[model samples]
Target: MRRRTLIRGAAAVVLVPAGLAAATSAAASPRQKSAQADDLVGVDVSNYQVGFDYARAANEGLDFVVAKAGGCQLSEGPYTSDSYAGHVDGARAAGLRVGHYFLTGDFLSPREAADYFVDNLHDYRSGDVLALDVEVLDDSTRLWNDAEVSTWFNRVRERVGAYVPWFYISTSALRSADWSRTIASGARLWAASWGANDGSYPGPPDLGGSYPDWAAHQYSSMGSVAGTSPIDLDLARPWAFDVSGPTDPPGGLPKTSAEQDGVPGPTMWKRTQNWLRIQSGYTGPIDGVPGPNTYAALQRNMAGNWGYTGPIDGNPGPMTWSAVQRLAAQHGYTGPIDGVMGPNSWRGFSRFINADAWD
Candidate 1:
């Protein structure tokens, strides 16, 4: 992969003026020398903001946007923001480099949330970047720790498809958390160190949460543009994304490592329950039992999608077996959907939703 030549100073002398930060150094030269167009300007928005005029923002010299698409609610659970799609379309219509972020938390498995995020959000398009906006730990409880942050970002790595997902966070948070080195190795970072006029970076512009320089810096959470009073205005160095490389081939486990190979164990059954809870109509505990409720939900899902129509009595009858085979067929099993779930179905099941254990 090709790397760009990045500017260095470690820390800025002072905050640059708001608007676009690229030309700050030029503005500071004693000889009145013209500085190269060094940085780009952008904004981030979410459901909280009333509205934005993307066309006006573009005309005002903004170069990019990082909008919010989803949020992690400790008690309420994960949900897509109401306005993300509109914001994205409007920003792109205004001809801006568009990206998006999703707030994360510590309640669920980081990987599980990441998977859901990737699945539910809009597809990534050209020039689109994804970010983990680790803003709050929890409203009423603990903040996300290093381990949680690491799992979130690491899982994010596998699920972000082609986009390079950055870690958007505050400078104080970066300094405080245990800091996931795993995330640092693969993810870009956007540091949130706010001031009155934060649209520009002054020093080496490096952030310490395991990064040499922050890919983007949010100078003001209350930035104004196109007449909007408070928008997240950002200043970013020229950023390039490396979207190609070897990612581990997906699939191969029904759940992480449930009792070794094909052998079905109580431990494996429990893990299956954990994965199963995410399916529709599963309102039971993850007790690892293949009880009526569990099988009922499974059968329900398989019925319409996998060509099954037996009584939903939570019974693992021929119809249920046929459904599993059909589901596996969609994933990777080329064989017939017979009652016998052979190696082909096992491989496909692993591929479709395999985790070592419960997510």
Candidate 2:
């Protein structure tokens, strides 16, 4: 059984640098042509901005608001944001998309911190954005290791059924850390980097070879929104926060005796490989070996519709199987979206891969 802990106080430590405030006077505008007209504009807030006018902000054209849920501080141990509840409620009432972020620290175990974060996130809905803020500001020498980061995401995923958590990190920190394991866990990237420190959307950062794509880019920390001054401004993709159902319908063969067996064999893999080659640009041979290239192609194919946002490293984990389950949902698989795959999940998958064209 999971242990629940009480949250202490309304204030928590915010790790944003003091130098960001200098750019507060700059006009909040998109300075780059890369800023697409369809990109959603939003702000992230914490206890520092109290009594924020969410209705006014929404009226002023802000699309979403990501509020600080809570965090485990070095000095205070664990605490909840005093304004978390208010921000969520106000944003929802004003018809703004809502998201919650937890500032992570090295004070507690990753599992413990994740549990505490979920416990304090009372207003989380099925599709609300959930992010783990990873940044160290003081003289603290301890930084979260890659394994710990993956653990935190896995723990959160275990508790929160279908929603995949986002990994929040600055450009410098992201470049320094080896987050290959975290990437394999299907944690979406929410990159924070303020270029020129001006209140303008400077477009997404170069990522410095960290990941392939970013779900959201925090362009400026000095953005002047309607209700809040010098707030963290962001441009997010619609698919990243899209809560609608899957994009494509299942186009698979009818269930056969082999699919009913619910066991994958060389024949099944060959069919899957052929499907991957035809659809997902897989150059791998149809040798019936489910190797890294095969799985990597599968990951790429499932990314847009089935929530497989992890690296295409070819090593399948819960995230990969969960995507399979989502695809399976259309093929008569009525199981939970938990990453655990069983006979039912396999049967549904077999039905899809056993199409005659692939054969």
- Best-fitting candidate, scored by TM-score: 2
lDDT of 1 by residue, 271-342 (tens): 455444432235566566678988876775565246566776787877788877766665566888777766
Q: Write one digit per residue (lDDT tens) for candidate 2, span 12-45.
A: 4445556656676664742232334556878888
**Candidate 1 error regions (>4 Å):** 1-36, 137-140, 183-185, 197-210, 240-359
How close is each model in CA RMSD to the real structure? 18.8, 13.0
TM-score for candidate 1, residues paired by index: 0.54
Instruction: In angstroms, give how far residue 111 of model 1 lies from its true place.
Output: 1.2
- What lDDT does each candidate get? 0.57, 0.70
Error of 1 at 221 (Å): 1.3
Q: Per-candidate TM vs. native?
A: 0.54, 0.64
